[model samples]
Target: MVGIGYRKDFAEEFSENTLNPAFIEVAPENWINVGGYYKKMFDKILEKYPLFVHGLSLSVGSPEGIDVAFVKQVKQFLDETKAVEYSEHLSFSKCENAHLFDLLPIPFTEDAVKNVSKNIRQVQDILERKIAIEIVSYYTPIAPEISEIDFINSIVSEADCNLLLDVNNVYVNGFNHQYNPKEFIPKLDLSKVKYIHMAGHTKVASDLIIDTHGENIIDPVYDLFQFTMELMQRDVPILLERDFNIPELEVLQHEMDRLQIIKTNALKQHKHAIIS
Candidate 1:
């Protein structure tokens, strides 16, 4: 399935019935205990599309450990909304009980593996449902004891959780770290991936690319997405994440249509290869 991220910036377009996606994703922290107009708009959107929640908290890799109270609230919200899926960044965003509002990269070490696995189990137990964790983009890379790919494989296996594969983040990290994005996709446990994210990035310097979900997705990221689907051998839901530079409703719809075409073509290629 294909979808768009629900943002209030497109509230008018949604009311006019211009945007049509199979599903929509939103950050639950923004909606829980909310009231009035936005809440009403969200309820209307829910009627037409399945709701998928992506969280900003949970801080699965933080030293502060899991926040039981926040997760309990999330469980309540998910049950109330009957959300189809929930996801969070694999990176940590909290330190010393204060929200950093940034997706900071976790150190690739054996100790971190155990820490993250325990945190994820706590969340899953409280929610009583598995949650997907996205491989986030980061500008800095600290002294890592293990490789990024190995670190991810270990966590997902130990935690027994799924993944929200962010194609754009892979492209960005590949560029910044001087690795081949094409070669990198195959190393991951693709079977663990439950959802996908595609977005745009900005080239601030000749060598650095920032994961800015502001511009239209470039051709390379799209290429990687279609390539990833071929490996999966099945359809998985993907969402076009345009969190900034809010474009016109038609523009977002056009992107969704292109994704549908690519998704369809990739699956056909896979089936044709099998039959051949």
Candidate 2:
């Protein structure tokens, strides 16, 4: 299946049914108190498509610790919306109890692992269901006591949470940090991947890439997503994100159609392999 993030700009597209997204993801914060036109559209959307809730401000790695009150509010939103799934980045967005306004990398240390794991557990306890954590992209490395993949494995293992794999992040991080993106995917526990996110990025320099979901999914990122589908050998619902510089609805849906084709072809190949 293929999906797209809910944005006000796409409201017309949603109303027209010109683009059929298998599901729609929205940040609960965006609709919590919204009124008027958007609220009416949101209600229609809920009645039309399966809603996947993605969060922007969980700040799972915050050293300030998990916000119990905020989590309760999130739970309330989820319950009200009847959201099927919830996901947040596996990075911190606050320090010293103030919002940093960006998802910052957590230090690759055992202490950091413990911090995030405990936080994840608390969130799961409140939500009463497993929440997916997306492997976030960061421009720089923090104090490294372990490899990035190892650190991620540690936290998920300890916390017993699902993963929201982002193919674009893997590609950008591998280019920026100088590693093989293909090799990185195999290291992850893909069985725990509840869904996948694919997006476009900015190539600021020949050697650096920024995970900017502001453009179309470039060929290389599309290739990475295809490779990921083949590697996982299972059909995972994929989402296309265009947070800014979003193109026309038809163009975006075309990208989604390409993703659907890749998934179908990859799974068929896997089945052929099994038959052979």
Give each model a TM-score: 0.98, 0.98
- Which pairs of residues clash in candidate 2, taking residues 3 or more apart in a chain or in different chains? none
Over 91-133, each residue of candidate 1 has an lDDT whose tens digit, in order, gives: 8999888999888899999999899998998899899999999
Residue-level lDDT tens digits of model 2 in 184-261: 999999999999999999989988888889988889888988889899998888998989997888998999999999
User: What stretches of model 1 exceed 4 Å from their correct place?
Assistant: none
Clashes of each: 0, 0
Q: What C-alpha lDDT values do all the predictions have? A: 0.90, 0.91
TM-score of 2: 0.98
The C-alpha stretches of model 2 lying farther than 4 A from their native spots are none
